[model samples]
Target: MSTSLLIMGIGGQELIVIVVILLLLFGGKKIPELMRGLGKGVKEFKDGQKEDSPTEKKTEVEDNK
Candidate 1:
């Protein structure tokens, strides 16, 4: 079996490909707007994830014990 990473971005090529795809899909004028929305969505999701994770509850219980 061979293992390959798909999103490593180790050589900046991953970013280049993503930029090309975004430009093709959204045009240069819209890419920044799309990225701004994407960034907000990611940030909101991360905040929600932190609020819902069981680890936080576990720590609360551990502290009580």
Candidate 2:
């Protein structure tokens, strides 16, 4: 299947419209700050996933024992 099919039928034009709406809503000056916050959120989510991985849990259990 094509990538658009995987995205539930949202194509390139739809993506552009969504980005344009975001830009209009947040304004150009605030977009960078919004993106920076989003980046930090993603980073924190990844870090949390790493901390909760099976290997980390196993190590914690061994340390406790």
Candidate 3:
């Protein structure tokens, strides 16, 4: 028999608990604004990382020459 290691498989109940915890910590009024800011921050960070990848760096050097 195959063995599985995951103890707490995430489901609807887990999501509801997570939402309730967030609501308690940040309150209902702030959740949307916080989530929006978090999304923007993650997007910008990923974009910045992608722009610095090796292929882009090689292109930048070729353009400068």
For this target, which candidate reaches the highest TM-score against the unseen true structure?
3
Ranking by lDDT: 2, 3, 1
Number of clashes in every candidate structure?
Answer: 0, 0, 0
lDDT of 1 by residue, 1-65 (tens): 11344444244576678778888988988988978999999999999999889999899989999
Model 2 RMSD in Å is 2.7
lDDT of candidate 2 vs native? 0.90
Tell me which of candidates 2 and 3 scores higher on lDDT: 2
Question: What is the descending TM-score order?
Answer: 3, 2, 1
lDDT of 3: 0.87
Can you write out model 3's per-residue Cα lDDT over 1-65, one digit (the tens) per residue?
11231345666677689999999999999999999999999999999999989999999999999
In model 1, how large is the Cα lDDT of residue 7?
Answer: 44
Q: Each model's C-alpha lDDT?
A: 0.81, 0.90, 0.87
The 10 consecutive residues of candidate 1 with the worst lDDT sum are: 1-10
Candidate 3 is scored at a TM of 0.77
Clashing pairs in 1: none
The better-scoring model by TM-score among 1 and 2 is 2
- In terms of lDDT, the best-performing candidate is 2
Q: After superposing candidate 1, which stretches have Cα over 4 Å from the reference?
A: 1-18, 58-65
